[model samples]
Target: MSVVVAVKPSARKRNAKVGRLVAAEGTRHAFGSRAAAERWAESLSTGDGHVWIAAAHPADDDDVDCYLVSRATNAKLEAAYDKRRRRLRGGEGGKQQSLGGAE
Candidate 1:
């Protein structure tokens, strides 16, 4: 089953309660794997925005498994995203880094 990634605006002081999360325009995507979905969600997360992951609910087959991302995970995702961006922009040796070490 495919996983979905969605982005929405975060709750602010003026809007203490976040509204129902509906996938905004240009902010939803599907991936073949949970890891890929999480990575995409993390890349889109920002101070003013929130990201979520959804999958097929294990308990109820017709239900969706969804949750808001934690702040700590967002931080880690941001770090990885930045590192990737830098590498793409030639900050690294412009050599594609292998996912497996010592390749």
Candidate 2:
């Protein structure tokens, strides 16, 4: 069992790009970009579930190449970042005051 994720342009937005995640069993999912989809797929692959593979085959008329990333790795990185951010904020997401220093 394996999953396939690909990045391509969006159908509704001319300037937007979308990613598609398709399982070998025919289940499909979509994401904002190839990186996002591959990240998700990588997470799934880390578990005891299906293996996730990223397909970067170029389109017939395109000259760009796709890439892949690990979801577990991304998750770890995000967790570390969030931890640092919380420390910087003293564990409280306080509201910002106006530049004039008045509430």
Clashing pairs in 2: none
Residue 66 of model 1 has an lDDT of 46
Q: What is the TM-score of candidate 2?
A: 0.28
Q: All candidates' TM-scores?
A: 0.33, 0.28
Q: List model 2 lDDT by residue over 1-103, tens digit each.
A: 2333433222112111112232232234546666676576456544232334356555644333342332233457888888778867877654555789999
Stretches of candidate 2 above 4 Å error? 1-26, 59-103
> lDDT of each prediction vs. the true structure?
0.50, 0.44
